[model samples]
Target: MTTTPEGTPTTARHRAPGAEDALPVPAAAGSVAEWTERYAHAVMDTFGPPQRVLVRGEGVYVWDADGTRYLDLLGGIAVNSLGHAHPTLTAAVSAQLGTLGHVSNFFASPAQIALAERLVALADAPEGSRVFLANSGTEANEAALKLTRRHSGGARPRVLALEGAFHGRSLGALSLTHKAAYREPFEPLPGGVEFLPFGDTDALRAAFAEGGDLVAALFVEPIQGEAGVRSLPPGYLALARELTTAHGALLVLDEVQTGMGRTGRWFAHQHPHLGGGVRPDVVTVAKGLGGGFPVGGLIAYGPDVAALLGRGQHGTTFGGNPVASAAALATVGVVERDGLLAHVTALGERLRERLRSTGNPLVREVRGEGLLIAVELTVPVAARVAADALAAGIIVNPCTPTTLRLAPPYVLTDEQAQPFVDLVAALRADLAAEETP
Candidate 1:
């Protein structure tokens, strides 16, 4: 048994045989229609109608309530780094939970401390680097925003983000987001944030020049996942770093969707040809960190930035949780031990090569690094293609009217990727015929 933060004793979850059998089953759990109906009444409608009621997953495939298996090309929007039911991740999470699942900020756990150390080392952060764990991508960005404010005690007020960037939906993270629809709804947001044109070097330089000393920080997604896997222009990140350093502003890289080996590197920013060889003062990441177990973090590069937050200025009850930390540690371990990063690099290259070889007119371009790919279409038929893909036992995301984003699991095998590649080869041909007559 374990106790709540308030010391209320509670029964600990078990992994013993038949333990899952004790789980309470929803009356509508057996069917997609029934579950969707129940979800409509009980859950928030934030994501719109249910696409399919996914029941379980394994390796790179997921099953719906109707027992239909799908080749999950999106990997739960890039969160499932290790794919589903990974034994290492499951064992780590299970063991940690059975021992110590959570605790208040007042206390500490071995898992939390070890995970922080690992992140700092992986980042190649200089001495005095520190890590702040959060529960989600938005929370990680929020913490980073606060850290920047503490830089020079709010003297620098201007913050920079790029157009077409999607940081998160939280008010603080949303302020850095570029989509008008996602931002305008919340009229009153924290101020001093400006959205720059994506990869416009002149605009970036102008922002630094205009903002001058008031530039507190600039947040960038090394590869803008929500903007159809758009990668920054070559040297863009290095230039941002130079300017931010010269202007005395923080250069923050948001790696939420591209970190945890999603791009065949530990972090997307490490990819020199694409993400640039720049070094950021602070880095925020989440998505694939916990391999779908909900964990995020902010890494302060050195002592000066690390000391900005100080103590009592920030706190979270569930951040740095033992189970989450364990999950992350396990995810990283498997990626290393299984040499999945190399697999990701080679497999992504193969898939892109195959797609580009098709010479399909609808395949306007294929961009992005490693497994995070985008097939930009010549027409606004991405939604139609995605629907077709769903019907064909594959799962993908139409990130835009003409962009299909694929961020498959790092463990995706060549055999598993062939179906999606074949679908792309023929999809546009079929659509082309439709528009012809």
Candidate 2:
């Protein structure tokens, strides 16, 4: 049995030991089809059929079970910022785990305290901001939602969320999420919430006007990731902040998908278009924060609202696991030390330019900030295009029927982006041709 650098045990338990290294030259039996069949039997179908059973990854490239190498443009749905098995993240997690793996919330570890300090510092908010760590993006939002209520003293408990916003799937987070399909079946959710059209500052103002002090918070995503990387128009977030502040409501920015340098900024709201030099009261982050190790946090600014959650107000068993904190610290350090934020900015501009240059009639629009990007096709064949791209040895995501999203690792080089762009262009052409007849 061989262990990954992160100390993750890799044995024949998942597949034959060393089988990934000895993959066939031209083709292999361990194709997506074969591995997908095995996955179906062994794994739950929460995320649907496997697009590809990726067995190995390095930087921006991943090899599927079939030994087919593909440029991973999706970056595991924007979680692997430094790409798979980054040495920094691996070493941090391994060393921290060896020294201290986990401790109950009753007792804190240095890694956990350090991670919280780092996140709060990175937020650059006032000195009194506090942090609550969680295990996933949903948990972060859930914790933040609770904090909002605690601060409001239950008098103002209603929340105003954006129409296309995706906070999370947990009960509390789902309360703020606006998708009918995701929310309807799980009705009788935590109550007192309203949804408004995103980027419509007028509508947001109207909602607060109607609700008055009843609104506890306005939860929003600086850039809607699950909604096909949709971004708010300039000054929308600033307007929300102003309206919420005027109404004595908290402005919660859900940066689960847009934070951690994904959008060339520490937080997407830091963008000139979004916050316009404003600061939000609450910010929730996850995804790339740990660079693949699950870690999420909620940052509450100022003492007025920071200490709302007193003892026994909130807790989690594995929220601030030492190993997870260590992983996040390492990720943040690398991002800062290597200056990846600027890298993402430059590379994102190049990627967007190349994608537009494809000039395919099917591409209706291409939009996104930094490494997080999306291409909207005129027709609703994004799933087919994604599949075609996979077949052509490239990986991307069909976020909507007509929109394809790409969130490649920050480590992705221009050389990697070029071929992937070419492959997407070719796939668009092929799909267009197939539809012509």
Per-prediction TM-score: 0.93, 0.91
Give the Cα error of residue 321 in candidate 2, in Å: 1.1
- Give model 2's clash tally: 2
| lDDT tens digits by residue: candidate 1, 1-437 | 12245432222323544457676745425788888888899999898989999987877888999889999999999999878877778778878877887787888999999999999988889999999999999999999999988994768989999999988888899999988899898968999998899999999999987757899999999889998998888889989988999989999999999888888899988987755667789999898999999999999999999998988999888999899999999988888887888888998998888888878888899988999999999988888899999999999999999999999878777767888888888864568557555
Q: How much is 423 displaced in model 1, in angstroms?
A: 1.0
Model 2 ranges with Cα > 4 A deviation: 1-34, 427-437
Q: Which residue ranges in model 1 land beyond 4 Å of their true spot? A: 1-21, 24-29, 428-437
lDDT against the true structure, per candidate, is 0.87, 0.85
Query: Which tens-of-lDDT digit does each residue in 1-437 have in candidate 2?
Result: 12356433222222323446764653345677877788899899888887777777766678878777888889889999988777667777877776889888989999999998998888887988889999999999999889888867879868889898889999999988988999999999999888888788778778877767888888989899999999999989888878878888888989999999999999998988777888999999999999999999999888777897888889999999899999999999988987899989998998899989988788889899999999999888888888878888888899888999999888877766787678657654556557655
- Highest lDDT scorer: 1
